[model samples]
Target: MNVEDAPEGVEEPQILPLDAWHRARGGRMVPFAGYLMPVQYEGIMAEHLWTRESAGLFDVSHMGQLVFTHDGDIATVVRALESVLPGDVAGLGDGRMRYSLLLNEEGGILDDLMVTRRGSEIYMVVNGATKYDDIGHLLDALPDDVTMNLQDEQALLAVQGPKAVDALARLVPGVEALVFMTAGAFDWNGHALWISRSGYTGEDGFEVSIPAEAAAAFADALCAEPEVKPIGLGARDSLRLEAGLPLYGHDLDPETTPVMADLGFALSKRRREAADFAGAQRILAEREAGPAVKRVGLLVTGRQPVREGASVVAEDGAVIGRVTSGGFAPTLGAAIAMAYVPAELAAPGSGVRLVQRGKVHEATVAAMPFVPHRYVRASASPQTPSKAGA
Candidate 1:
């Protein structure tokens, strides 16, 4: 989703704990997801390049932090979650996390989230704009024994890039030991923190979940490091796009299915065999027969950037598909985009035509991750491959 624009019908924007801190550092504040957030600090291009070369900090406190617990069987809680989400929650080991999609009864995606198994409690981070809707859906589907706690008092931050580990490990020792998609509990200056070795950028990074009251101090400490600087939502969007990650409410929505969105990897083999999750029948059938349209990457032929709402048209000028995400890729030094097109035209190297405001632009279908991913993983660990956009 575009971070600069707030959704329609939203109430007055709320202030985050770091509102003053951001403004003090010259952050350009804007309305986003019913909150006044910074869209840029130094600048989008400067911050985007800095994160790729060194380390950049991001304030993602707007995301929802949820914890699930049960006094009864933990297996019951797993079963309840599996009924709504397609991921293999039972197979997740302690401190392990998985990228999952919240699906409707028809198999349409309601929201995309990260679910981590932390001992007896299940921790989840959902998109800020749809957290309340997601909570309502889970409450209606979960068993009475399963309890969901929304951690509104927490603030989330992400430090990402080649040197992110070096900068963050200094504040909280032992965080460097965690591998990709793993998490652990730690303490810093008497405050509790739940940190995970994962992030939206396709670089080595860590996301810290800390107490909201101590957020400013923690942010200050992080930025004090020579290698780290505070980044904004603009660079975060470009980074995730270059990483070929989908943005919720933009690249994914209720009308989109996992198969159609090219996110079939989220469906574990064990769950696919059992065929027990929501929308199993339609999803499985689409997996076998193929989706009508597939999400693919596009390499524009010029320096001019393409924005959302552009159309993928046929030779005769009939609208065939639409662009979901598009922008100038700073890392690639060219323009790139993500769009849904006919399955026949989804192959890499296939030619396509794009039209925005009566101007036709030539583009070629290409593989995703316009930029290569640099996540750090242990060779001995049997963890599954890292999921895009997690």
Candidate 2:
């Protein structure tokens, strides 16, 4: 199931901290986001299901982790961030995190990210492919008082699935207290790490940011657990797809706004009321009057998986939209896809047609998250020993 990198002529991809570990474990390394990442292990199907039933460790070191500081105060920096981001940075409580988007001047999405409030410093994790662009934009958009620190020496690992807590608890105790969307600073093997109970799999999970040198050992520790297995990018994509979460370059881009992408929830209530963020005028207007087109889920009829760039047509064969992401959902055992189409035709059960590679297939508009989200709420009891303490 290993995926290899670029052909002979292309330059070799940059190696991550766990490159050796991945190679030793039969990972299929492929070029992604300027790095060589494991695309699959045993197979995409097995890895995807393993994550749903148990825990899967993923090396996401390619992502960019940033820390923001302000000389005046954290509040000042938070306000400055609000100028470009749509989330209420000032309202974020200690150790709490929120999913947000960086919007362009025209209300289009530049990138999607996870913002966590950590005492004096605000932490952010942006997509690897757009991290540089995002950093450049922030450098120009933020006020002089705010300082952005890019943490390139850190490696990220996601332990995700229903058994994630149990598997992770074996190594780090006291983390069970952290509920969904919450983060905390913890120690593992004498090394400090920031862990958040959030992930893209629509399941209970934790993402840990550790120093690059210690990443391999930390990943090995997590993988040693009986419930944990190393997963790859292939499963990662399928999992997010099943969760109906949009990928940046694919489902979302600079040309799509939050309203158009069906991500209005990311725009905090106060932010919407104030309408003070980037492209507020256009976003707020779209919220009230509605967007012309909307991102929607599609249930592809038959076995073929409709892929990106496929034309979405109306009943009369008029091109109305295009597919952005599509693939076979292991959990659902059916082919599913995402596309942007007219608002009127975005409703569930609406009839549509997908033309891919000259093959036209019938499809039906479906509600997102082809699978139900199983995020663990705060009510779950925390009980596990801390291996690090031992």
Candidate 3:
């Protein structure tokens, strides 16, 4: 009797604010995230390469944006949220984004999302399709004192790629200074925009939430740039997969707990020791017992890519698990995928067999992110340099 297992029914398809803009640009519309969003504009492979080599614009208006505010201590407000999420929400610095999960009572993940502390409140952005249900869940779970508000007036746009900073810097001077996972409001083209120096693709980029009415103009203005071309859902999926990120329904769901999904790290040590969060006991027990099966990255040895739902077989021909997300990684120029394999066979450097086209394709359990992430980092390792001073 869970929400995800609710009786089969269909709701009328919805459209984003930029639906018209997408069609006018010759985008191929498809159903995704509960909206008739553009699946590809200039084709998937081309758009994927474009995002890596230059810049790509995406109308992520389908994503949900919300703002929350309450009286008194921020810790109290954050604690209420942290009780349900896996991340150390209480320790997040102002304007810093933290990736966490919304958990069910049994510690199963409902969604993964970003939370940014802004001033005396918190700003949150979640997947487009699950936002409404997520909001209601939060409302029902949170204490009465905690308040939540939907930022219905906003629309989201993401500008991502290697040249994302320079491409966006033209509008908001000094934007390049913002480090990864940091966000704040800035003026762009005479309109106030909330720009976050983070994105899904494995590159330096920004996700801007602007006024709904101005979203079209802002998107158009960015698209006018030489390097920025409109990308669609197909590219977005490929990019995130290449970055080793989990898609909602594919990599996460109510049936899979955070520990089983290998996302227990999102739960902070402080929270873990305190054991105050939702489904903490189950999540903690799973962590100790070691999940039977876990999500792992795969490096398919051949050109034939294993698509989702593809069965993974052990050396002895036993069905060990199944691939949850798979595709050709444009950046790596090879097929990559994520699968849930028995813990015994999930180690990196291990070899497995993937069945595609009813034929066995040799694959290795390579570490995630078949491609390297070029995030804007400072004072860390020899790699991952800052965009501004690099």
Candidate 4:
């Protein structure tokens, strides 16, 4: 399909380069992140479980990749970025990445994204559904000298799970030297690519940004690794939940501030001290006094899982909030959900109930990362103190 250059009004929802390949492998296509992606290859439940035990490949080409460069001053351009984002961009070094949020005037989260400093340039990846508006916001708020380029030629693939590290190490030797949130360029079969030791699954994995034309071929190569299987959005969602990672539209939005979402840590010590980012006033205020409601993980007692938009209630039956993201955690072998409830009820072991289909299932507030993280990070040394880059 000649969709890369298709006119705005004439195009259907974009398809990743691996669309046909996924279909050939029994993938069940579904619309997600504004792209027609595979929701399941073999089956949702089986795929979800496989990713927990072995590596799974995901075509995330629908995500928005943006490149930014400074014309005269890099720091000056970064400060402009800080003006709208709650991240210490000025402190990020080359080859490092940080998680951050785009905040509104009231400190509400507009979107959550990743920012990486690649040599003199910066790269950003935002949720596909929010990419259009996110780019417009950055263009309007950032310094005039800062140029933003949508990387329309790039396609992103995520390989995640326990075996991810070993699978990638075969192609990109010494990647084990990289830490979480760090990335570098590598060459595979004559194809140049950017690989980041980052993923939403909380597993030891890499997100490879490849040229649109090379995405499918590289994915096929990785699949050649005996442990690697083609995963779909269905498994991706479940894996992230098992990791307790938040989903943008479900766990966060323009209505929920960072502090409210339990993501105040994204606003680093420097950004907090500098106090210059957008909605800094409101965000800091919430951090000081505590948010009225807080996001917390829920562990259901029953086998059936409660999903997004399910009402949360007090033990006495008073509706307090709603479940944001949830599913049966294959790794945990239990039903888990993330929800927001009154701050007083946010603590671990606090009793709460998930009301689904008119039946209230007993659950409780709990610490997240319902499953353990197996992230591979850089080792520390005297010269590389705290080598696990921020």
lDDT of 1 by residue, 1-390 (tens): 001122345478878889999999999999887679999999999999999999999999889888887874567778889989999999999899999999998999999999999888789999987887888788788877788888878999999998999999999999999988899999999999999999998988999999999999999999999999999999999999999999999999999999999999999999999999999999999999999999999999998887889999999999999999999999999999999999999999999999999999999999987887888787743223344658
Clashes of each: 0, 2, 0, 1
Poorly placed runs, candidate 1 (over 4 Å): 1-10, 380-387
Candidates' C-alpha lDDT: 0.90, 0.87, 0.81, 0.82
Tens digit per residue, CA lDDT, model 4, 1-390: 001221243236777788898998889898886789999988878888888789999988888888777764567667667788878888899888999899888788888899998877788898888887787677667767677788878889998877887898898787767778899988888888898988887777789998889888788888999989999998888888877788889999999998888887798898898888888888899999999999899999888989898999776778889999988987778899999999998999998888987888889788877876777656632122121211
Judging by lDDT against the true structure, name the best candidate: 1
Q: What is candidate 2's lDDT per residue for 1-390, written digit by digit as tens?
A: 011121233345678999999989999999998789999989999999999999999999888888888763788878888888999888899998888999999999999998889998799999988887888788788887788888878899999988999989889998888888889999998999999988888877899999999998988888889999999999999998888999999999999999999999889999999888889999999999999999999999987899999999877889999999999999999999999999999899998889998889999999987887777657653332111100
The candidate 2 region of ten consecutive residues with least summed lDDT is 381-390
Candidate 2 global CA lDDT score: 0.87
* Whole-model alpha-carbon lDDT for candidate 3: 0.81
**Ranking of models by lDDT:** 1, 2, 4, 3
Determine the backbone clash count of candidate 2: 2
Candidate 4: the clashing residue pairs are 179-378
Instruction: Give stretches of model 3 more than 4 Å off.
Output: 1-10, 380-390
Q: Which one is best on TM-score?
A: 1
